[model samples]
Target: MEVPAERVEPKVEAAYRALGERVSLPGFRKGRVPRALLEQRFRGQVREDVIRALIPESYLEALRETHLEPLGDPRVEEVSFAEGEPLRYRAVVDVKPPLAVKDYSGVPVSRKEVTVTDEEVEALLQQLRERAAEYVPMEGWPALKEDLVILDYQGT
Candidate 1:
């Protein structure tokens, strides 16, 4: 999808100004640097910020213009910026494919019946009792198959 020139320009300028506010120069205090000096000193950083800002706005515009519902994030194809010019980029996106439901209302579904039994409840109670059981040190002859070994585990 193509992004309109008019809409993107103002956003680019705003991004540039915002970037200028955060950038520092040799003589200028924080957020007091001139726009021209900020451009000269931090062209790459400013362009990156402007492109980051422009892409989301441009993508939204592209979606509205084309009337497309995107399925996932768009893949950025290309981005370009030059001094005193608006940032530009191309993006490729996957849109939701057209679909039709056939006999959806008549589709048969089955659910298994479940009932809690006294035996199952007793088994669960037994497990909880085991979890609450205290561990006591026993005279060892190495660990056995059923022994629960409590050890302090440490790792780097």
Candidate 2:
């Protein structure tokens, strides 16, 4: 993806201006620092801010231009930026591959006969009996772990 000089210049200028407003240096008032001084002192920061702003926007614009819908977040590979040059960057993206379908009249498939054994039937009946069991309150016995409990309470 390449962003033109016209688009890159404004964002770089804006980043410098925003940084100058908040940074105070010796002999210069806030927001009164020269662009040259800001560039000298904070060029890396300005570049970082501009790139953070431009990369995602440029990636999306590139996708729209080429009509490519990526499957996941892009891995940005290389980035090159200069003061007056177009921003050039490369990103690796994942996309679905094309599918080619063939004839599907009679695909070979195999089947196996299913049978239930006596032990399996007995296990199923035991599970059903357990599920059908009902709870009955024991009036005189103390409740233990795994017992269904019923509590009566009043709240004010």
Candidate 3:
């Protein structure tokens, strides 16, 4: 993405004018700082600001000109800028690729058979019994705090 000198010079000048307006200098009223002075005092800053402002704009402009639609943020590098010269740069952009329409009419999908054994069924029944159990009134009997069950020992 290279912005020609003709385009960049005006923007740099505009940036200088904008900075001059906001900055205060001794013996100079606000917005009255000269362009040369601004360039001299804030040279690196002005260059940085101008380049920062130009890079994205140029990148977008190039994209539009090339008719390329990008999918993500660009990786910008190899920036080259000089006073009174064109702003040159290289941006690695991730372009949106055209996708093909997929046909699924003939696709085969398989399902695995899962078997439930007797133990599984019993476990499910036990879970249901525990979940559904509720306290009920005993008929013709007094309520007790606890109950015990007696059973014979057996092997599985």
Collision count of model 3: 0
Error of 2 at 103 (Å): 3.3
What's the lDDT for all of these models? Answer: 0.76, 0.91, 0.85
Give the distance in Å from residue 41's predicted Cα in candidate 2 to where it truly belongs. 1.3
RMSD in order of candidates: 7.3, 6.8, 10.9
Residue pairs with clashing backbones, model 3? none
Which residue window of length 10 is worst by lDDT in model 2? 96-105
Clash count list over all predictions: 0, 0, 0
| TM agreement with the true structure for every prediction | 0.54, 0.67, 0.61
Where does candidate 3 have its weakest 10-residue lDDT segment?
Answer: 142-151
Task: Give me candidate 1's TM-score against the actual structure.
Answer: 0.54
Clash total of candidate 2: 0
Instruction: Write the residue-wise lDDT of candidate 1 on 1-156 in tens digits.
Output: 444566566765787688777777788888898877766777777667767777887789778987889999999976766645555677888898878877777778899999999999999999999899987788655888877887788999
Ranking by TM-score: 2, 3, 1
Off by over 4 Å in 1: 83-87, 101-156
Tell me the tens digit of each residue's lDDT in model 3 across 69-125: 888889988988999989998899788888798998899999999999999999999
Q: Candidate 2 at 138: error in angstroms?
A: 9.3
- lDDT (Cα) of model 3: 0.85
Which candidate leads in lDDT? 2
lDDT of 1: 0.76
Tell me the spans in candidate 2 whose CA falls farther than 4 Å from its real position: 111-156
